[model samples]
Target chain A: MQNLALETVAPVVESVPVPKITAKDVNVHYGEKHAIKDVSVDIPAKGVMSFIGPSGCGKSTFLRCINRMNDTIPICRVTGDLRIDGRDIYEPGLDPVLLRARVGMVFQKPNPFPKSIYENVAYGPRLHGLASNKVEMDELVEWALRRAGLFEEVKDRLKDSGTSLSGGQQQRLCIARAISVRPEVILMDEPCSALDPIATAKIEELIDELRANFTIVIVTHSMQQAARVSQRTAFFHLGKVIEEGVTDQIFMNPRHELTRNYITGRFG
Target chain B: MSVLYFSLLLVMAVLAFALARGRASSGARAAAFHSRPNYHGLLAASLVAIPMLVVFVIGAILTKMIAESQALTALDPALLTDPLRRGAALREIVEVANGRFRGNPSITLQAAGDTWAYVQRVARFSIYGLGLAAGIGGLMFALRSITPDLKARNRFEWLVTVLLMICAGIAVLTTIGIVFSVVFETVRFFQKVPPMDFLTGTQWSPQTAIRADQGGSSGAFGVVPLLTGTLLISGIAMLVAGPIGLFAAIYMAEYATPRFRSTAKPVLEILAGIPTVVLGFFAALTVAPLIRGAGEYFGLSVASESALAAGLVMGMMIIPFVSSLSDDVITAVPQSLRDGSLALGGTKSETIRRVILPAALPGIVSAFMLAISRAVGETMIVVMAAGLAANLTFNPLDAVTTFTVQIKTILVGDQEFDTAKTLAAFALGFVLFFFTLTLNVIALAIIRKYREQYD
Candidate 1:
């Protein structure tokens, strides 16, 4: 009787349009444990897509796959097709370093280097040779910080330690650092989990404002956070995505029992 | 003998009774309870033991001395007129009284012998009296004071804690006492010899006039030569050890893999465990000859007992001191900093050179300072490899004598203690202590300041 009801309701939910990043039969394994099963999904370009799941369900793993950050872990192994803008990143001769420059990341915990705020934002640009002179580098730093909404608060203390900022400010500093390189895609792994509620709201507003410029993929534990910040939501359980669609329809009317139970607070 | 033994038994019996009474009272609950059963036992034991041990030890020593003195006083007047003869007569009398000597005695021997017998009787009686008093007093005290509420455990713990503190303070006091003794004797030596002569005179011959008619050599006591020799040898040691030890520490902490580090660190530390005497012989026989041969090839004249040989060997002996400490401090730097640098696309070597080395600079400085101090105080290597002549020269190929070498030479064999030559050792010791103490204090202050900046 429940199967009949789910079948009748599934067609009423409209699927969101797929993005330029498409993963076909992607699998990730850490030694004997399969972290991500065979999964296929497409992330839309110039839009915010949030990966929401219970803890240890590989939401962060799927997000890391976009930037190839899992290559840093010695024991992790990834197989199958992964492409960005129809170019296969896993192909031979694709340097992870250059790929990471184009697809930047922000960690869950704010990890600003123990250096001046100017140095922290200028590090990526200096490495990639993005600016021609000192004046150009200064302009780029100010532009990135202003876009991240941290220029007004920290404009006077450009030479102060990056760690001297508060938790919310440090996270925003990390975001400014990512944007300084002008990456095509920004992957955030629970960027606002460590911040207070007010800081979280500000970060969510920044995400909505960022959707017009670049693709943003966020992994969060809060389903409401996904609803507030993302245009599309992908729900994962036990290393598999049960359902994904427009954010409002997934919340008000989910096809899978697990997704409905999770949204309605019946069980997670 | 039976009365003394019975009194001891009575004391033990009273202690057992008190413990049993305390336990029985505790079982009644409410207002009857006062203290734990174990507290009662300890209280009774302390009361019985302290007084008895004190009285027994004191009485035994006093009684023996008094009895022997009285017997000596009763010798005949003629025998006593000659002090040596009277002393011999007293000894013989004691032997005879103790049943070790037997002979027909003259008037002096008879009188001495009669007094000795009386002394023996008095001694026996005194021992019995002391033991009886101690045992009875202990039992009465225990019976009066074994209350249930007494905090015996707390008092016992307090006593133990005080004793531990006293033991720790004794070590510190002993160091201060030694320093004061050396300073006092050195001051006395300086008073007899003019301070200007001791400090400025280049020739160090410390003889004096043996008699009024005979003029002895007026000795020179200048310390410039000794100071020069010490500084030259220590400088050579620092030259040899500093770079090698620091490089080895860097390699072990930053470059070596886990398997290599585990194997190499222990092998390096084993160099420190070898006895200094063995190193002295190796330096004297092997290193000295080798250095001489090398110097001959380069058209330099090197003595068999040159400062180079001793400094090289001493440097080898102190390598573990620098390497182990430097390695520990380098490894103590946080891994987060390393990861942060690597994540910024910096190479591993660049990160270690620019970030890690600067962070560990203060600790490295301290390690080198400690090694330098160890090099300065070293004795066996210099004594064996360097000659005894105090040469005021900086040439490494020449022979030099250090302060420790002079101290050993002056104090060895049969020598007159009152002469300025012997007393100079005390002065040398005082100077060495101050030099090392100042270096250690400066190193500690620098390290503490650096630590504050980071932590």
Candidate 2:
């Protein structure tokens, strides 16, 4: 795998790939509590960037900040220069409804709409008017499901409720739902946390394949998971980014004391 | 005497509880026990109270029955062959014993009344004795079982669960009792007036012959007029309330801010708290005249007390049922579902209309069915605003009586109990029961199916 990655990809820092997502001094507040402090990083385009930390370390919160999902929380307030494709997403004129359609999200728990599998995938396209007619919509749904690796198992049962699927299949259905809109960037909040080891492998494999077409940022608790699927890894603790670099380097020679302590299983 | 007996029972129960607690831990300090002392006390108290109450109730019933039989002996001997005459004679004798007999009593009647009073007193003493014996027996048995090894807590909990089940069973038993009583009287009514006529007949004047010679109204017992009137008024009410209430519920559930929702929900509920009789008066005194005057201007022949007047008020009363229940079910649609919809970039109104409504369809439907059942059973408004004319018509401008109103009218005025006119009320009640029960069953089935899908 290392031989293949080294042969196919340039050194991330040396090539200076254009940043697909950039955060400068991002902070989040939930009511009276300051949840996320100033955090800054640049995510290279078209690769998986994993955010790893202990629980309550603001990894998921930071991931949600990308698509403005925190805006739904009435008490939550975000102040930062978080940009995607060189555009400030938190600008006053920015439409979260439109931004959400462009930058999709998949949550830790698989939350499919209480609808059929076909309709679940088609919901995004129909909502944003992505498809002009029925044929285009059907083709888009099948393509998304196939890319999510759920088409073979569910093609015969597309009319069945998405909720009736197994846990891993449901998450794939959610992934299919996210991709059906042809989003530019996808934010995943611990997408594989609720799956078994085999399901987790499937999700990891899909993430590697998805890295080719979309800029993906994933928040995971497992160091091994970050090592396996991510190209660049960021370590967050106490609402601040401690270190970020190539996945192999972050796992092999972490620089910060706290990052080393967390990666070495000494203390989180 | 009952008051004193109940007091004695209460005192014994308290004493038994204390004594059992003392007995369970009566040994030296730090003695091991299977259950807590409080459980022993609770078990003992229950034993002392529940059985004694049961015996007391049984003794009271037997005493009354014996006293009645003894009083029967004071009646005239010839009347015994005819049970009906015997009952009437006993009633008069007992009335005489109370010194409220209308006519002057002869020597034999006065002597019989005296004996009847004495027999009642003796029966009362016997009941008191039996009650005391039962109470003491229960106390002794409970005290004997007050040991450290006894599983008092388990027994007490099991007993409480059984008692709770029995209390819940009372509601089921009472419904069955009502159905049986109505069915019995309805059968008697059917014997006099054919069932086919009652069900299919068009006319519904229930003033049947009270006496054979005095030519009174023979009374058409057709149920169609009242049934149609009920359906018509209820339909009007639903047509008025359905869209308005549903929209109000939608706004409250989907669009209202937290501050507004908390304020508006209870205010909507207060509509339900207003008594139906007051609504009836409002319909009669206020809305009816306004409707009639408006009709006069429009050149429509509207009755003064019309179905429109009754139905409008009924619809107002039913609004809260739809709004409050719809709000609950909408609020209960998992937050995850909402987040999923929102993440798809569906606007607020789009998400609500397409997702929330479809998800909440079953619950909303059940809420409407419940409101309709309430409307069908509503009596006071129809009786006051819609005159009790059993006119078979579909026009809302006409005054029509509902089944409930007819039931009320038939039983209220001066009438003989055995007359077909009065018995017709029971038949009406039986039919009304079937309709409301059918509605409730459908609503429940829908709700249950919904829960199965979600849960």
Candidate 3:
């Protein structure tokens, strides 16, 4: 009876055409503790895919692995095949530094560089040597800010410290910073977790707009946000992905018992 | 005798605590105590200890005065008129009373000695009686006041706070006292040598005549040479230490693993723990000759004891100060900032140079200033390695003397305090103090201004 119910309720996502990122049996360990255990998922290109789970469920950890940001931790170790555009990112020849440029990240809290608003937006472009001259760099910075929907709010005071902005503006500035590098993918780790409702709504709207051009992966605790913004939703529990499918089906009719329990608030 | 009183006071205080705690705990069964039994015990102990300590101090002083006055009464009035004679007679009387006198004593001296012994015994007994009275009275008062309603903890805490304030005030008052003493001596030095001539004149030979007919030049009291020499050596020291220490801090803070940092930071700080005298010897014996050899190879004249040698060794000694302070501030920069930079695809070096360093700039600048101040105030290295010649030049190859070195030279042997040469040490000390104080003030101001920037 259980298998019949699961088979009927589960959404069939068999036609994921040319997924932008693919992971097979990916495992992450911090020293002796396994944080992510044999997780496998394919993230399709040019869409918002949200990972929804309870806290400490390895959702953020798995998110960080995409950009190889986990390389910074001394004890953290990752194994198994992880790829972007069918190229293995974990290969010894592929530099994590260059990989990060191709895959930009926004942190849980809004972190703008302790510099002028112009400098914060220009940092990634400058680092990647994207702009050739002062005029081009200014244009690039302005374009990034416009893309992140923060250009009009901060157009008058480009010279002010980036930290001087409001919480929502700072998050947008960080988004601009990430987008300035022109990455193929953007990974956001609970980016609106530290913002108020209005700020969260604005960021959610920006994320929706951004998915038209970039393969965006977001980790959020709010199932409402996952259902509202993402086309696909992956449910994680106890360091494992329990189920993944189209967002409406995942929320309305989860296949796995664990996924259904989590979505319906029976138990995290 | 005072030892006996001290023991008596200790016993009384302990007994008072035990009695008060027992009373408070027993009363707690009937009613509720506002404070714990331990607080009640502390209040009792403090009451006994404070009053008894006061009585002990005042009694000791009063007894000495009374014994000295009583001994003086046995001496001739005419003999006591002269201050010198009075001091000698008092010393003899004290020596005889203590049974340590060896010289032959006149009849009056013998009588005075006997009176001194008698008066000392009486006075000591009276002090013992007074201290015991204070201790017992305080114990009884505290015992009577032990009730469940008494707020013993608050009262005891207030007393503790007052004691802590007094201890802190003593440190401040001692510093003020030293500053005043230096100010007085510096004023006297200025009276003998005009401020303009001492400050601006470029000569520093401080050899003055000891006697009216003694053969010596009335010294040139100019301090310009010493001032320039100090600046030159300290400047050299900062140049050497500033970059090396900052780089070490950056490497430790940004790149080194946690295990490496934990072990290496202490070892680096041990550089500061090496006795400065040892560093001075190293400077004089090893570095000085090496510099001289190098200078000779380069066809340049380097003194056997050059400012460069001293400055380099001093710089080595102060590296820990700069590195340790800079490391703390750099490490204190929010980890989130580093993450933000790294996530933007900035390389480690780029992130450190442009993001971390710029954010930690004020702290780094303050650390450098503190290191410069340490170099300026350093005495032993300059005294042993640098020559005594007060050369007014910026050349590091030449031997130069600092303010501390000159002060040491001026005050080494017996000399009259009234002379300009002797008083010159105090003036140099005052100037050195003022210079370091200014540096510290500016450094602290910079730190305070930028402390809240990241937050």
Candidate 4:
């Protein structure tokens, strides 16, 4: 693993952008289990970054750390530096509620609120006071839905429950909800795992379009998906980042033994 | 003693016949049958026991009645003047004839004893004849119908199912019967006293004749005072219970840890187990005096048995009724909704207040309605804490008598059945039933609407 990091292939030959998020020797412990070891990583702005790992490898934990979603769990403890856009989210006087609004997340299971489709999309905007009036809120909801490519299918039934939509449409409705708040960044945890292949393709296309406006970070188990949607990919193993590089190179070229094995379907 | 054992033996014989028949007719391919052989045994046992038991009970009752009547007829007619005296004399004659009496040295008594003996013999003969005829008739009919292909077990089970349905139907029918009885008696009461006077008249004193020549005073049948008293007490009770119970429920469901929840819930429920009579005394002796002192401090006259005292204690009794049910309904609201609200950056209190409470509103309303019904039906607390005076005013501090209290007062001591005093209790009960039923129906409708919202 040390030799692979040193080799570093072309390194993109471009000026590396300033890190929007930096984790300095971050470690998380859930009771007796050391979920994430001393891991350091930096994520840059305005592009899709993918975290690829086997199950229970701390990929989801690391994503939750960005938004302080782990605060909801009583036993989970994170020690060391984790900053978003150079701001310490865990600093004294920092409110997780405020931080969550600034750093939005979409869950793996596509849990849309048991509310009307319009309400589902407008919920974040309403909570964050993103829109001042009903008309503005309506426009914001439509914009978010349009961005998620769900407007055409759900436009006629904005008043219907979000759950009444198909599995794929529900997932998109969740995405629309996340985007409605106009957060600086969106964290998606296996956003397409519960969707069919067609929906998966649609979400991948939406992710590519989303990268033009907002910084997007997604956790996915599908290597091909990571290659298709992400500009950069990080491979995790045993709660440690084994390799991080351009997605194309990571999939096709030589890398760490574990990363190579995982990419080639030799082993998880 | 032998008869019961003999019946058991007959049942066993029938079971053996059915089991053997089933086994023999099932042929070499035993597994081909739809049901097991024991089912046939049970069916045959039921067929034998049911008819025999019915005959035994009927014959026993009939023979007992006939024997008693014959003994009464043989008794000296001068000793049995009325139905009450006749019953007592007949009982004594039966005891004497059975050799349970210790009297001796009288020829006429001995002759009467012989006549009693003859009556017993005739009754016994009648019982034996009826029992034997019914038993034989049933046995023959059942045996003739028995066949190898007969699915007696299925038919018998179906009959049992219908019997259970009838039993349940009887419970509903019994409730209806009781309601109608109250309604009919109340109608009779209203016929004597005009409905308008009963409903709108203020005074409730029912006068009775003090002497044979003195006519009873004109009794006031107004129910307004009782209705007002009931409303005042119920209002105070709801005031005490509604907010406290609902808040406690919210805390238990949303905020309490598992350890605190497990301990607190049962302790709260223990309030419901305390007998209402005990609470009544506590209210009467302790709370009423304390309230009077408090009222004195405020320079107000609070009656010793005030509506406020009774209502507060009754409210305490019904707290568990509201809290436990509300807790269950609030907890039943999906955790996903909470998570969704929190994920959207809503504060915990905000999420609970806006989302969870609204979703659980109907259930909470139903819980409150149930509590109200319980309050209306409660008798003991009001009887002890609230006074016998049916004051028509709505003031909680004033002495008041509820419908239940009035009913208890009217029926407490011996009174003539024909008087309006005794019958008014039924009328009051009917009004109470109507009020509680309306509350329950409205609450149920609200709950149904909310259920449909979620479903």
Candidate 5:
């Protein structure tokens, strides 16, 4: 692999109370192809951090590493010092299953399990044994659905199939499912990418509300989405993080030329 | 004479193709032709071949009728009073005409023979003339019709479509024909033996007494024992195949690496391709004795040829059916469902059991139904390993018989066609057909209901 001689900026973060997740020199490879390379960043507690990039720039790859979702791919390899709350997630003693319980994900496409709406929301809690009785499980499902702002619309048809919901509703259902287990961190991989503008606005609003209780990391292709929803924004280009800073400064006065060109839609 | 006509038709077809292609591609209107010159040529050749073949076939059939009628007319009226005697006389006349008769013939028979030979020659000559005329007419018509605006390609394609339709029709019509034939025999069997007795009686001895005074040979046509025996064996087979096949499918779909799956799937399917007769021999010779020995060692008296042995082998034969169908449906389950469960902190087995299996339940149920039908219809293994006794016992250690085994035993001998014993096979077959058809219909219903769940 030839190393480009472009200017490399350090990961810059403005003052925050504390960082909930941290990464140092993270790299990912799918077989021989280098994907994410030497990227480092800090995600603050209880705030939305968005990674924006072009389609093949490894924003999604790096997002999946938070929950070890990429471990399902047999050929993918990850190397880095990744920690959640000062604990290494990739330590030999850590079980991916347990780590996933504390880190929930919402996919780009609305992927609700082929099950009833109630069951979809309750699935995680059931798996983790969070509820001791039927009443507790039902209450947990309703609370999760209400937190994701999808309870009123789907409350009448709780027994309906999860797939029976509309595109936007299904994504919200997935969000509800993710939060049913009450994870500390939530990762959204372009969750609003598959929805219309109306649904997208609703989800954006919900993400802002969700930031009060959970540390959220989101990957988006839309620069406006990052500007609107995120407090911190990281711009990735060619498997490297070009710049990271407060969202306002990153969009208004980007230090790196690549980040400026990408944010301004000069080229992506 | 037939060979001469066929060769003449082939030559004419070739000539028609060449002439039609030359005219269609001529410089005068070559650029304006609707179809390529090759299509025009193909259309002309087909026109020549089809009409000529039709004429030749019809003409040959008419010639045989004309020659036989003429030969019969030349015989004396008084000699043709009896139908049997007339048939024999006609045979002798045909034999003499062909110079195969070895004995001396009477005067009238010799004259009839001469007339038969003469009439055959005249009819055959006229048929050849008619066939040639039809071929020439078709060729002339095809040559005149070829022009720049003619849709020769469309016409030829229509002909090809008709040919394919005819081929498909033959397959469907043949299946209907077999069903009707079986139905008719079943009706005859019902006429001789009451349907109630055949369907509801417990006894199944199908031997009819040769004389009225013969003792202990009364035919009893009850089919209950066969039905019970069939259910017992098929039940056992399902018990064995259902779990093994489902587990194999899950292992291949979820756990096994692609390299292992590729090699293991075909090796498992090879069990299906092994001849049931070969499997039967293994069941009778090896598994049966081993089972018996095991039973005796445990202070039990297992039959030398037991239902357990046959059911085990039949189960082996049916495993591929279950696994292959199951593997397909399990693999067809979308990846998103699996991912959703796994991301929720569900263990791999929990995800498979709670989420993936429920999503694929409809398809898996249908696969099991199809496998059960296959086990029900299997015969050779049961025939060899389960003894010829109609023991309606549910115990796997006892010898038993099934519907297919009884059907095979009834049909595999020289016997009078109309006897109740022989016709019973057709009845059993009809019942078996109904059983499998019902199962398949139910399977299709399940697949139709849930096919669109994931998409």
Candidate 6:
């Protein structure tokens, strides 16, 4: 019965005309540990999707695989077919550096470059050659910050250190940094986990606005956050997806026993 | 006598500690006591030990003065008028007291030696009495004062704080003492020879006559030649060390694999551990002659003891200091910065050059400063390989003498005091000290101002 529930809901999130990310039997291993078992899922293009699970359940691992952030870990290994926009991301011709530029990431803790606020946002545009001139680069930076809802607060002191900002402002700055290069997708690994409630709500609103242009995938610990920010929701348990479907249906009528147990506070 | 007195005091302090700890915990429940048993023990030990040490030091100084006076009495009144003869006579009397007389001693001298020995014994007895009194008095007072609610822990902590302060004060005071002595000697030297000549003039021949007929040797004391020589040698050393050491450090920190780093770091540090004298001999015997031969082959005349040889060896000797310190500073840069750069589509080389190096710049600058300081103060290699000729030329093929070499030459075989030749060494030392001090201050200020807080 659990297998049936998982199969039925796996393809439901990809019902759009063209999917952004497609995975088939993806398995991740960290040394001898089978961190992510053989599993499959599809993320729709230009939508907000959330992966909710207990701590250390491989939700963050699967999220890191989208942008190849897992390459930074020497012991981690990922196998099986994974594609974005109908092209294999792990193909021989694709450099992780170039792939990462197309798919940006925001971490749980805001990690800004130790530079001026203006430079932090301008770094991506300059490196990717998104802007041709200095004036265009400055404009692109301003536009990205405005889209992330940070320009108004930081416009006057653009030369100040990025670390001098408040935690909420810094997270927004990281968001602006990701958007500066005009990426096709954004991978957020518990982006609001270190933030206060107000800051978390602000980021949730920003995620909704970002869905029009870029696909967004979020790994969250909060059930309410998963329900609030995502249209499609997946529940993971023991390194495997238990059930995934429309957010309202997953919460209101969970089919699998483990998913219902986790949502109803019976067991994780 | 002072050592014996201190050892006896140490034994008494230990006994007092045991007694205090045993008594403090005798009747009360362990939980009821305000202070732990260890604090009570420490308080008792320190109370007995500190006063005893103070009295022992004072007694030691007094005993030294008394013995010196006794030895002075042996000098004849006629000889005492002459400072040099008086000094020799006192030395002889001290040898008699120690039972190692160098020559035949007169009756007056042997009698004075007996008197000195007797006085030393009396001084020892008096010191022992005073030490015993301090230990007993302090122990009795400490034991009587201990109660159930006494704040023994706080008192012990304060005592430890004072002890640490005294240790720090000793180091600072010793530095001040050295500076004052050098300044006094430099002043005396300036009074004999004008400061303008020493600072600005070019010649540097200090001639001391062998006899009256070997006269007309007023001895020019111009410091310009020595200063230029020192600078030329140091510049050559820096030219050899700066780029090579920095590149080695960059490779170690940025590109090397973990296994390579683990194996190579210690091997490089071993270079620093080798004594500088071994390098001196190698420079003198091997490198100098090789350069001279190589220069002759090219139709270029190189001195047998060229500045290039010493500078090359000195640079090699200090390479470990530069590489190891720069490696640490570069490796200390946060990995997150690299990640940020790479995620922005920058290549590995670009990330390292733009983000990591910029962030680590201040630390690397300080490493260079420290390396330069090491180069300036180096003694053995310069002393052995570089010629003693004080030449005011920038040519690396010619031999040159550094400030350290000059100082060592003047002070090695001492003939007399209050002479211009010996005092000139102290003046040179003061200039070296000032140069290194200013460099350190500038380095520290750069480190402070550009410090990137990454937490």
Candidate 5 deviant stretches above 4 angstroms = A1-4, A7-17, B1-164
Clashing pairs in model 5, backbone N/Cα/C closer than 3 A: none
TM-score of each: 0.68, 0.92, 0.92, 0.80, 0.88, 0.92
Q: Cα miss at A166, model 5 (Å)?
A: 3.1
Clashing pairs in 1: A19-A43, A19-A44, B35-B148, B205-B219
Local accuracy of candidate 4 as per-residue lDDT tens digits, B332-360: 98776776667667788877886789778
Model 2: per-residue Cα lDDT over A1-268, one tens digit each = 1112222322222222789989888999999988888878899899999999888989999988898889888899999899998999999999988999888888889988878899999999999898999999999999999999999999999988888899999999999999999999998989998999999999999999999999999999899999999999998876777778888988898766667788999766
Candidate 3: which stretches are off by over 4 Å?
A: A1-15, A132-139, A146-158, A164-166, B27-31, B64-93, B105-120, B213-216
lDDT scores in order: 0.79, 0.87, 0.89, 0.81, 0.90, 0.85
Model 3 clash pairs are none
Writing each residue's lDDT as its tens digit, candidate 1 over A176-255 gives: 98888898898888999899999998888888888899899999988889999898888877677767878887898887
Prediction 5: B-chain TM-score = 0.87
Candidate 5's error at B303, in angstroms? 1.5
* Candidate 5 residue lDDT tens string, B181-251: 99999999999999999999999888899899999979998999998889988988999999999999999
Grade the docking of candidate 3.
medium
Model 5 lDDT at residue A203: 96
lDDT, model 4: 0.81
Q: Which structure is stronger by DockQ: 2 or 6?
A: 2
| DockQ of prediction 1 | 0.18
Query: Taking the tens digit of each residue's C-alpha lDDT, what string does model 3 give over A15-129?
Result: 4676999988899999999999888898999999999988889999999999998999989999999999999999999988898999999999998988889999998888889
- For model 3, residues B236-302, the per-residue Cα lDDT tens digits are 8887889889999999998998899999999999999999899999999999999999999999999
Q: Using DockQ, rank the candidates from best to worst.
A: 3, 5, 2, 6, 4, 1
CA error at residue A15 for candidate 3, angstroms: 4.6
Segments of candidate 6 deviating more than 4 angstroms: A1-17, A264-268, B66-93, B96-115, B208-218, B452-455
Give a tens-digit lDDT track for model 6, residues B1-455. 55667689889999989988987888747567689988998899999998888878898899888887776776567878888787787777778889999778799999888877888888888888888899999999889988878899999999999989999999999999999999999999999889999889798776665576786776778888888888777777888888878888999998898899999999989989889899999999999999999999999999989899999998888788888988998898877677667766677787777678777878888988988898888888988888888888989999888888888888888556577888888988988888899989999988876675333
